[model samples]
Target chain A: MTNLMRGTELARDIVLRASEKAAGYTERTGRKPCLATVIVGDDPASVTYVRMKQNRSHKAGLESRHVALPEETTTGELVAKIRELSDDPEVHGILLQHPVPRHIDERAAFEAIAPHKDVDGVTMHSFAGMSFGHSEFVSCTPGGIIRLLDAYDVEITGKHAVVIGRSPILGKPAAMLLLARDATVTICHSKTAGLPEIVRTADIVVAAVGKPKFVQGDWIKPGAVVVDAGYNEGNVGDVDFDAVTDALITPVPGGVGPTTIAVLLEQTVDAAWRELDA
Target chain B: MTNLMRGTELARDIVLRASEKAAGYTERTGRKPCLATVIVGDDPASVTYVRMKQNRSHKAGLESRHVALPEETTTGELVAKIRELSDDPEVHGILLQHPVPRHIDERAAFEAIAPHKDVDGVTMHSFAGMSFGHSEFVSCTPGGIIRLLDAYDVEITGKHAVVIGRSPILGKPAAMLLLARDATVTICHSKTAGLPEIVRTADIVVAAVGKPKFVQGDWIKPGAVVVDAGYNEGNVGDVDFDAVTDALITPVPGGVGPTTIAVLLEQTVDAAWRELDA
Candidate 1:
């Protein structure tokens, strides 16, 4: 039987738990778990994303502090702003929206956010922790993917997991997480030759190539669990959902999106609890 | 004819160049490039390794600072000592011999070495950098492997590289480096199932599993490149060198050993130049 792993329903349960935890922490510590979102150069897409995140933060009983800088802001300026939030005890989580103008050094800005406040898990410390199996927080999409796999009772140990991307935040971290769970992980990028043949050998596949419907059903092995981590234009995902004859997979629109945000909020509250307890 | 990739000959050239640079820098600035070797317990193998590194450092016209701590030294104390070396301007490189008594936390100690002086490349900073393509220094054996492949004109782009280990310093970093160079990298550990079948598909194979001749010759594809990065008892490597019929491979004794130490000395000199320039 072809099973659709519904991420939206799982996300509802996760967010609800985070909300409850946030409320209890706020009542005890006299402070709401706070998330600080930083953005530069108001691209419409980025602005919309930030607003959606802020709304979710509020609904989860957490405070959202948004910092918007001008388009011409230097990498130095951006890093300074992030550092301030990282040092602020009030901020439990720090998130800097992606594509912050090509002029700015994004890596430097990500590094500036202190590890404790790095709920988004974009910093090097978080990356090392993830690779070394001592992660405090994982990047939201990867975390959500792991949650989805576990929720569906998928066994990771001794399985072959093919991760079809190498982006630092998404594909690379996903591979590391799967490897930590005892899955023999293979990371494929655009430069990889015979990618389809490689993907066909996976017991579990993570398609994070960002191209719409990039993975066809024929590329996957029989009864493999496919995780489509790409959200492209026209409400499409990396996997062609209509083409799959039989397999457990995530759909484009309601799959991975809700869970991604849910994991972010959960980790934010988790950071708050950890910090407050300290 | 299958050519043997000789690491010893290549390493001699590398060390000679670094020695020349060290002499010029010492002549101009009146200070030798310095490496600090830290050891917690008197493990015989580790002591021999440290002494060899110090000897190589002196031969390369650099200073070797040895710090011997008691077996009862705590992780906190070890970190404090490494932190002192990290802060010292004279120490251009820091190497902490691994297996620091079963009680001490090794990860915390590795994290203590600052990225600039992390010639050993065992820290999280080094791992993240190697993974993300901004690497300052690589872990010695992996760095040597890359150098050997390049020197021997082994094409990496679009090739399948199967790394048969997952240690932080060797297999993990080696996989990251190969990925950075556009190879399709698969990381297989002890838990990996059907290991021989996976090894048979690789264009390039890195044997770092630390077992003596664990990889059988029949496991290799024809005309593949095998990097034997193991130093087991009786000078045996991970790959069974005598059994391989038609593959470019490294031998047990003279393969990765010389190049590993040579790379450390070269990087120490390189670090001195980078810091001095800064």
Candidate 2:
């Protein structure tokens, strides 16, 4: 009997709950829960992602505002635009789509969003708050992963969990959340030696590296829970699913990707709740 | 045949060099490197530490401006005092002695000091900057440990380094710095299972668990360079010195402790340089 952690279904459930909450808030206060999407350049992948996010937000009964910039946009220009959105009361959640043009400093652009409206949790301030276990906006993918693990009744405390990647949004924040859960967390990246050997020791392995099938099936310990956060080319993931039959693993395309937008919408409703109280 | 890393001697050398640089800067710019020490109470240890730092600053030809507050001072009052120091042009480094009265929120106190003047590196901003591999004021002890390692020509890149502890000041930042150096870093805290077995795989071990002699010598891999960043009661460290014969370990009292002050002084001078340039 295979116990699959279905992300698309879970995401649908989450989006519906968020929509209900958002509708309740709108009824109480005449304003829809608003999310601002800041996109730079005409990158196809970025455009697709932002459009998907906006579609999801609209379906969740949240207002979606789009700010598109040209490819030649400067970091200062992007930062100014984000700051304007941050100051606007209508924008409850701000999503600065990643991989801004190479010339524009991405970190600087992300920092432009005010901490309160940083619903995507891409800012350093949000990162620090999350690491300190404070109640703040969390990185979307990691936050969604944590929700998935919780929904599955995965016992994280005292578990030997290993996170295979160190990206600011996904891997690092995931490790911090796991650490806060009383799990013994270890982060492995490009510099890591003996990758397969370390994977065999994990009670929970989070394969977040973008490389396809980096973690082999034989490397997974028996009964170990696996979270493949990678969305690589051709629907491949960081972990090789064919090799592992004894463990519970999230599917590549339908697992982490669907939850990203769900978490974003959930956070939008949360932001609205906080703003109403304020 | 002592191959041990002596932190005290190294720290003294660093302090001496900082003193010379401080003197030179004063001669060139007609102003001494000044560190403003803000203390909220007369906690004996705090007072002692402040006095020790002042003495060292004086010896290093740097000026120390002490801002002493009453024991009953509120968080707002303490923050205002810290802000005053932070804004003072005469002060290059702002050091808020920790463990401010029980009534005061110490984190707020740390936040009051601007990141540029945060030589002690206690603020979340400074922590994030250092963790992300930015050139910022690092936590004194961890900064000292890295300096000690580099001075000894210990190659960190592509090496297996295990850090024991998860404290903001040491363990987490140390792991980040090691990762920046291209070393595979693992942070094992109290919840870590079979820590000894994990440590055995490390080529470099940083014991910062705070418990005296918590890491056994048998757990240390042979010829691994050990940095004992812990200082507990009776001048004891996290590692059992008697248990390890093959590993090069840093002793308790003479190890990470002395280097803390050295790093503090160096960072003060660095802040002075930056402020003058600005």
lDDT by candidate, in order shown: 0.93, 0.87
Candidate 1 off by > 4 Å: none
**Residue A30 error, candidate 2, Å:** 1.0
DockQ of each: 0.91, 0.67
Output the lDDT of residue B215, model 2: 91
In model 1, state the lDDT of residue B139. 91
Off by over 4 Å in 2: B101-103
Worst 10 residues of 2 chain A by lDDT: A1-10
lDDT of 1 by residue, A1-278 (tens): 56898999999999999999999998998889999999999898889888999999999899999999999999999999999998898999999998789999999999999999889989988988899999578988999999999999999999999999999999999999999999999999999999999999999999999999889989988899999999988889999888877789998888888898999999999999998778
lDDT tens digits, residues B1-278, model 2?
22688898999999998998898899989999999988887987789889999999998999999889889999998888888888888999999887778888887888898999989988887877776777989989888889889988899887888999988778888877787787877788887878889899899999989899899988988899999997776878999988888877788778888899999999999899887788
